[model samples]
Target: MKPKRLYYWLMLAVGISGIGGLTYWDFYQVRIAAVTRNQRWVKSVSELLHSEQASMARWIEKFSIESATFRDIANSRRDVAALILIDNRNRQAQRWVRPGLRLEPLDPRVSVLQLRALETQKTTMGPVLIIQAKPYFTVARPLGKNRALIVFLDAARAWGLLREEASLWHIRASIYDFEKNPMFSSFDPVIPAGALAQTLDRARSKETSGIVRLPRRLSWKWLITFHFDPASDWIFLITQHTTWAYAPVIFFVICMAGILLIARIPFMALVGTRREETAQALAQFAGRVDSYIRGRDAMLQDPPSGIKELFPIAATARWLIPQWKRAEAFPRDLALERKLLSLLVESLPEGILFFNAQGGVQLSNELGRVFLSLEQEGREARMVSGVQVPRGFLEPYLEPVFTGAQPNLGKEVDVAWADGKHLYRLWVERVEAEQDKTGGFIVVVRDITFRKQWDYVQEQVLSGITHDLRGPLSAVLGYLDLMKRQLGDGAAAKVLEYLRMAREAGVRLSQMVTDILDVVRFEQGKIDLVIEVIPVVDVFQRIKNTFGVIAEQKKVNLKLAVLGDSNMTASGDRKLLDRVLDNLVGNAVKFTPPEGSITVTVRSENGRVLFDVVDTGRGIPREAQSRIFDKFQQVRPGDRSAGYGLGLAVAKFIIEAHKGEIRVESEVGIGSRFAFWIPIRPPDHRAAGKSDALVNMDPNEVVFPPPAA
Candidate 1:
């Protein structure tokens, strides 16, 4: 416990102990004085009774055989109820009665009294006797041989006198016989007979006068000082109520409690003043420390104040000020470095953000807040400003990085606004605080809106150029073919061959122009699709028929195989589907050498129809695979006779517009397999806007089989 609290309790305990000791001593003295006074009163009453008995005995002796004199003597003392002179023969010879005395005819009581007086041969006092329901006591004296005088004392008159004496002392008196019956009482309250009897029995065995307690219902109790008379076999009890007896003690206790309460005020006031001073000192020191932390100057030259115990703490705080200032030197440099880095990041065109492991934004530049769509001014403005980006886009990607599950973290992902007005490309890089432990990620974003618009414009220009050239190229090829036919073997063989070469070149040029037009049209989403269910076997048969003659002329074996429910069908425009197969098969036939084989396979997989064009040829290089399906891109670019490289690109657009996907799997020395899948139920064309649908597609869905090893 603290010293202050311990002292407070100690003072309280001492105060209570002193009050209790003093109250007990005072109550004990009052009780002793009361008991002593009661004993003296009882002794004086006993002495007075003895003197009255002696006087009565002398009067009887002097008035012997004088009836008038006996009457006069009995009348003179009201304490005497009657005078009876009995013969030795057990008979009442004469009876002198007071005027108000209702004496019954003397019977065996007189005989009993005479016998007791003769046995003792002196004055004898009888036990309290009842006559006509009133209590009386007899005093017997032997007058001469064979005769005795008996004095009957009225117990009621004696009780009246005792009551007056008890009132003066504030006590109640009761007289009980040896049989434990109450013969006289100073008051009318019921006495507990059993308890009185027990008390009398104890008093007889012990001293003549002592104290006893009697209990009553309702928590009432009485303190009784009792005196026992062996001569008369009676108990005289003086009782005082316990409540009155303990009144002084109660008063002392209440006064002491008040005194202790009053004394505590000044002590508490002193302690409170001391505490307030100490608190003020501590608060002032805390303010100084706060100022130092905030980079403000604070003076700590003052000496320690307040209580002695708090002095050491105040001094320690004063000593620490200089050390704290010195410790800030390195952190100042770190702060400068951090500021420079932040400025650099903010100056970049791209948006940058730093996130902690739990996906909360720790730092972000101005562009980052704009990209995230966060508040420009608020508590959240210091970090990433947006509400949606952190939870919707960033956290999903960052979780795998923080858990050590993703070793490669740099990835480019697209984020689009809700209204689709702006789009950003985010380059995310996971940064590690320790080896194999990720701290956070750095996100850099760039707005690619203008670049996308430029690409679209370039496609439109190419489409227009291709559309304009196709008509003239077709007419030139036709005119040349007609001139060759008209010459018909009459002209020179060299001339005929040159004309044939020109016609063939013009025809190839026209085909290239047509392919370019198709690519542009597909890119612009202008190609209308006639979607219907087309059987898989029928599509495969059509592909073989279209390429069978070319394959035979090239001396390459071409075949078609149907797998897994040959009766299955795909949903798409039949012409578009046939054109898709024609482009893939033509590419295969052009690349495959003589004695090589080409196979087209159709199968049902994952609720879609899958088509595969496999060929044994000089395979494409790994570096060229990614862009092989792009417009005007070719794997063997130097070969002029390879025609325009729009075949695969056109095929991809047609497939994707139908909500399908395409991929190429090839090895440098081995063959290539080009595959694509179209859903059995194509999605609504209008809802599948070209850019949004392509952006949302999962790249993992476009998988290829591994090389046959």
Candidate 2:
């Protein structure tokens, strides 16, 4: 026991001592590096400034031309203030100076160096003059017995050159001339009142560094002050804060913490009896699996024995508990969702059935069974994925759906059964399984017998009424025209104006009824397109002729642009295409305010003809753009005077009958642009004969005619 106690004490002592030693070594090396770096910076900046001065001096002594070369050098070198030439023999002085030089009055003491240069006939450097925080150094070079050249160079230029190099080594660096006048510094640090003078005195001595404490703070900083005395007489410095200088303590603390943590292992082991730690570790894992299995949160610790291998299984089980819980609830949630869906389907007006791939009824609503004439005698059965149902009236439709003749998703078709009395519409859609495989088909049935009869009756009534009314309306308009022509010279002005108004009203009513009848015919797919080659230029001319008078009357600008060849002809019905343009442009003219403009543009691209009628007008609202093509849907719904809105519906049908598409884009305050594209190809069977528009056409498609009233 005594031996073990002594061993632990020794380990504690060693650990503490090692931590202290490492701390000392790291700090010592950091201090050494800091000092070396400071010395290098001081020496490098001093040497570079002097070297630049020396080079300038040599250039001055070698240059031949007096003013031009000297002025050139002064102008090029910003550091050079001016170049002066003194002729002792002729007693004439010439100077080349740079502009904007706010140099201070030269120190009288610099004359001593100038005299010495003349006496010795050798180059000499004068005292530095710090003018407005800039160092101006003078170089005196004697040229034979008669001439002396004096050059003034600014050391601030060298600061700009060497400042980047100093930052690469020391962050805070500075320079001063022999007179202790300030020169250049990179960093801004608050210093004591006498810090600079004291630092300069220290730099003058053999010692190159000292410490300066900041005022009102507990921090002291290192000041590295070095100078070139005889050669340049310029002092250089670097400042380092104590925080960065003492960062090594943090590293030492981390190492000590690591050591202390290591010592805790055996200490904890000794707290328990021999093999007691292993038993406790084994104990922590015992309840982990049971707790996790019971769906309780459990923490697992790795066993300190060979049983740790089995520990991962318990850990993985801990991770998998949430997934297991989700899977356990999934079946219950799915059953509830299925029950809800079946109830919703049974309540729907249409009958819906889901069939699996094997021709079995997997799921069917009550309405679906009733539609299929099925009677269930048992209690309400729970629907399953692969349940079977008896074949009945729907079996024939099922065969077509199962075969390749029908697609995965098919259009709804009219079904007439029970000797055509029972009319139904059926749509079949695929319910895809995993990986794009066929799962089943979802069939929807809606009985449309009453709807069909209602529509037929409405069509017959509309036809009779329209046919009966159009003639009287046209005759009223015609007689009004004739009376205006014959009685205009004799009739009162108000009577003539009333006749005109009546004629206009009759024309609008006639146009509305005619458009509605046409829309019905288009919906029944009775109208056919007369496919022919349409001359695009001729079409534009006709548009201009048709709308030019109306647009002029309204004070609206109507322009036409044919962005295709002069002989550009498209394979489409000429009259139908004109109607499309007329409807679009006519609306533009109708809604556009006075002085607003409309553009009718036609272009051919990619084997298709594109048309655009853009207008600066009272634009259609965004919500109305979609519904404008719908029958009787006026852009401005409150304004019933907009010709009953059947014009666009008719235009849409005509465009579709010719195998083309039309769309409208409008903003409330801006304008509207109706654009459409038609395939410019030779008439195919559908275009030349009859289109699917005959049966499947939307009243939302077609073209316009003669600027709809």
Candidate 3:
């Protein structure tokens, strides 16, 4: 046999043998231990029974002495019902019977007890007896010259004591005389008839407690019998059942047998299958390894064999082949990689430059050379050209990157190049060597002159529009209002209502213009927040008053809830905060249909005051939820009456200027909740200055012509 197969067989044999041996040894030890424990229990029960017997004897002796003394007293006074003293002739020697007391002679059972006491010349207690349907037990004591005194004890009381003592041990006990006649028992039914004789026969021979199998074969039961009083030939018997005690051993044996039978089949099959599989895997591995060494990648096309031991070696061989090929042609691969990198760099819109450790230009793309005003030349001339660029321009930016002083190496600096005719955003980065030391620096430059020029033009246009439109829009709204009042309550009352509606529209248009101007001012850093402490409850109440009438007119339930510390205050511009609240609440009321509810909730959270405007209406779509705060972006763009969409955008701006955040959550058919937070104390005024100008641009930049008559 092969060594591997032999080893497998040997291991199987050892395993089976060990399991069988341990099972048998454990079973044997358990059985022995169970038997020893049972024996000890039996001994303990026997000792307890002997102690009970001794106590009974003492009580009997005390009763006998008391009865004897009472007999003497009764002999002096004939008040007792009956008192009799018996002598050796089975006759009463001294007797007293009260008048009208027709006492019978002593019972015939007392003759046997008296005989026993006469024979031993000691006290003797007899088994219980019945006379005239009343139960009794007799106790006899020897007098001098073959005479004895006998007293009958109440049988019920005597048996009750014995039963109470036996119950403490949870055992049922019975007493029998030498002839095996039942003297007293805890229960009426004694041991089964077929087992009684056997139990008695064992007790006679053993002279000590011994377990005897009972006739009932339902479960493991034994009749444990021992002599309680040898001199009186009285025996004690108890029944014991031990099936529960032997259950663990029986279950373990069955389990071991079942496991041995079941395990052998699988183990044998596994041994043969594993050997065949190992051989097949080895053959496959050899073929794959040969293919790999021959530089053919085709070996990887086949699926892996399910052999854990060979997988790592096969994988390593497959991986090493590519590395080996690369190593053989490393110079060619390196040139190709460098050429591809250079092409990629040159194709980028931004300029890229590489500087060596000595601050000399090692490589520069065409854009980089043009941006830095460097001329293409041989290596030495290229270095001289790099020196021509102002040292003050490059050193301040690149020195920190190359010297490792600035761990975050990328920064955008505006550089004026080509004699101040161009502006480039110079991004400087550090390149590290193998040991993380500064190897060199790479600078990326992007021209932003066009972007700066466009921003300047946009600023001028927004300024002119803000200046030109506000005056005329306000005049148009004022004239419309005056015309509405002038045409009041006559046949033109309907026209007056139409005039009012038109004036409200003009007013909204004017407000939109004002919002755009304010947005521009904020973006230009020309607006300052007049920060002050404002009570949140007062704000909630003000919002409630502002929207209450509009909500009633729309038949929508507008409610305000202040949660947790209604007296809370936040630091912000009161007018700005009021504007934010007005915007959010107005939006909520606008979209919400009749009978739909709008709630404005003010709560304190995380050291900030949070405001939430939730509406149960046609909810915003998930796709539009993110852009709802963006200027002029409406959730329902088809509905142009949704009020210009500038409200949420303005609210977001004002909230963030207070160093806060605004977020919206919405699902298509459920509802929408717009939430914003402002801190308890205002942040640095300068921090809010970091607002992006692009975000704050006017969404409706088109200048409308004035309304025609």
Candidate 4:
């Protein structure tokens, strides 16, 4: 055989051995899993069978006990018939019959046998019909009241299930008399005389059910017999077999075996063969090397007598030398490439810096050095324009590099800088390197002085225009107000009404200007809040009185209820909270139907004080609630009802400023409730008002009455 052919044969043998071993292992594992699942299924079936047995026992007991427990119904035969005792006299002691069927007389021989059996008091009886042809189990229980009640079970259906579905089990269940003679059996089998006598004696002696296993036709089958005393001398036998109960488990095991054969074995074989082939190849290569070395030494020891032998040794060495050389160069080549890339990265422009995870710079390029030179008083790089920057100048940026938290700007931050000649736009980004090394950012600083100048000019012009109109608007409103007060009646008053309308228009314009200013302040983080603890009752009273006159004119019932008024104070910005209350109450009045009610409530719950304004009005639609607190947003189309759509937005800001929360609840076509909470203890920036009770109401408006159950 060729050497290569011999080597392949050995490898095949090794692979086959491995495949055989793996097949055994896999088969064992699959078998174990199948057995476990089957065992679990069997256990579950056993438990279910046990539970059913107990239930049947209870059912039988309940049936037997009904004779005396419901004696009136038994006697009247309204829902049940009376209990009867068939004694040795061949006559019933008591009989309650339906119209058709009559009780049968007991034959003397049978009666004597039955009476003797009754003295033993076995749990099972036979040939007793619950309803004729429904030949069922009969349990005779002796009532403490001296009555014998018999209960018949319709177990024929259950037996049918066992036969049809539980085909796996071979069951032969029967009811036997206390004398050990079979009264009823599914298929009569010869019973061992000793076992039969023992079962009968057990039934007669035990107060509860008894169980046993029996061998029939040389097959080990389960004979589980349980009984309940339905009447004096009768017991019901409800027997089941293990195979019948766990038939599904058997089927599952068969299916699992098929699956393992079709899938698991092939996969295990493939894996084992590959592993064995690899191991055999490695072992063969080593063996060949050892042989070659020994051959070489032998030749050297005695001057290799032929040229052909030496040629083979030389050829093997030549092959091994090249493989060793290639293996040696692989790591060197990788190291050389990495070094080259590092050199190239050190020489880029545009502030080429790598950011660490904590937003600090780890490396920077030439342009980065130049930028840093301008930003910090003294900062430098290891290489500046291909030359080393001094240590003194590089020290400042090194702090961020070492800490890995701040980016070396390599440039000055010119944001809000007043210099006209220099405007630098700075960009910062974060990146992740391999092995958990975080690089902060590649910062680029581009000068945009000319563009910045244009932006500055635009902002100045806008601010100027907003500022210039305020004085003239104030004068217009003041003059219109004075004119309306003077001209109270007649045609001049009508002319003054038009002037008043113009003044109101001017006031709205002024408020819009203020909102624009507030927006600017908010964006700049310059908005300041004046917080205070205020009586919510007072705030509500002011709005109610102010709108009360308007409400009277419109004939709307404006009801106010300050429940728990003795504890109505809340800690917050008084003015801001007032604005929130005003906006909600105003919206309520605006949307309310004529003569509808607007109710304001103040109460305390948990730790916070709550203010609620409920309105029987045209409630807000579901779609509008989410956007109601946005600036310049209004639910009313076309900005109707004297609102600039800034009320809720402003209220939201003020409430948030006080660290309070607000929520609105409403259903379309139903009313709405706007509720908010204010903390009892004012925040760090204290405002001078106590979290205490408010003044009593005008009494004309709704007041808090004593609570009732």
Candidate 3, residues 345-369: lDDT per residue as tens digits? 8898888888775566777889887
As for lDDT, the candidate ahead, 2 or 4, is 2
The lDDT for every candidate, in the order shown, is 0.72, 0.69, 0.65, 0.54
Model 2 scores a TM of 0.39
Candidate 1 structure lDDT:
0.72
Error of 1 at 61 (Å): 99
Q: Please tell me which model should have the higher lDDT, number 1 or number 3.
A: 1
Question: What's the true lDDT of residue 121 in model 2?
Answer: 88
Q: Runs in model 4 with CA error above 4 Å?
A: 1-465, 481-491, 565-567, 636-639, 685-709
TM-score of 3: 0.39
- The C-alpha stretches of model 1 lying farther than 4 A from their native spots are 1-391, 394-451, 488-492, 549-559, 593-597, 636-642, 686-689, 698-709
Model 1, 369-404: lDDT tens digits are 675554223323222222223443444444444444
Error of 4 at 280 (Å): 78
Assess every candidate by TM-score.
0.39, 0.39, 0.39, 0.32
Worst 10 residues of 3 by lDDT: 700-709
For residue 470, what is the lDDT in candidate 3?
A: 85
